[model samples]
Target: MPAPRILGAAAVLVLSAVILSACAGTPEEAAPEVTGNAQTPTAAAPEPTATPEPEPASTEKPTCETIISESVVADFESLGWSAQESPLYIGSTEITDGLQCMWADFEGPAGDHGQMYGWAPVTEAEATDAQDELIAQGWQREEDAAGVYITESAETVIAPDAEGYGITYLFGEGDVKVADTKQNLLLIEWPKS
Candidate 1:
């Protein structure tokens, strides 16, 4: 029985040596061997891109005073009309990077004596998109020597049978005349440099 136990111990040692030799093998020896000359890349090369052109510089800076010509402001003052500057754009979509100016005859109610003008620092593409969206929203697109006009109208007083209230946007270069629908005869012009 002792002789049989000694033979079994020797057999276990031989099996352990074979297992150790396999465990200590190199990465290449452990991995399955490839049979072809084909090779796989870890990463692909990037495609070439064109150099982007720089945008042209803006020619003017706007402010409440500069937005409206001094002479026009003076004329309005003579008529008891005063202009107010707002950091917030009226009605909606305020231009934080630009100026918003509103002129009104504060002596009386708002009525048709209110006009707003604004200029935002938007790219040409953005302006085009805005114009397109405005047109899609039922605003008519009209072209003229002065530039462009996109307009829509609604009723304000809610008369029994009324026509239009007047909502218009007149723009050129990159400025907007956000007047109160040009409701009054005095139409304001917004300039952008």
Candidate 2:
């Protein structure tokens, strides 16, 4: 009876040792792998977006004639003068009663008379007719540099009663005045009171 009891106790101790050893060596049942289709890779927090910059404003250049024309128009309009269309030309050289006049001021003082050129297409017959008419009217032909037929009369009045097509006069430095006139359709240039 004593031998059987001792054998039973020994068997129990060995079984306990075996259970402890297994627990120590074996890895834990890797917490029930909570795998569900690899949790849609937490969309890496969307990178913060950058704000865009605004565009710059545009700068454009304006022409010279446009400026001069506008200025003349404004000045005349202020003085109650209505402007009429006239032929466009450079300076005031007169070949006929019908001429286009433009003025140019080279480096000079204010109030100084500048060069003027008048332009008109005059046929030989028309020229002869004009000369005869001027002679009849007592306008003496003044001898000038050859090729330029100059006839001077007392300052001809520019009233509505004048006999020929009206004249258009422009005033300015070569470029700026022309630019303004072309742009603004300004009034004719004339002596200011």
TM per model? 0.47, 0.25
**Model 2, span 1-193: residue lDDT tens:** 8999999999999999999998889544334333675533333345688879786553322222222346754554454443232453323223432333334333334552322223244555545555566556654443322232323343642321132312222222221122121212233232121
Evaluated against the true structure, the overall lDDT of model 1 is 0.60
Model 1, which residues run further than 4 Å from truth? 1-60, 87-92, 107-112, 154-165, 181-193
- TM-score: model 1 vs. ground truth: 0.47
Give candidates' CA RMSD values in order.
Answer: 19.9, 27.0
lDDT of each: 0.60, 0.38
lDDT of 1 by residue, 1-193 (tens): 7998999999999999999998989644233345587554434345689989998886666665666667877877788777777663423355456666777787776585556655555555655766777776666677788657666634332311133535555556655555445443133433533
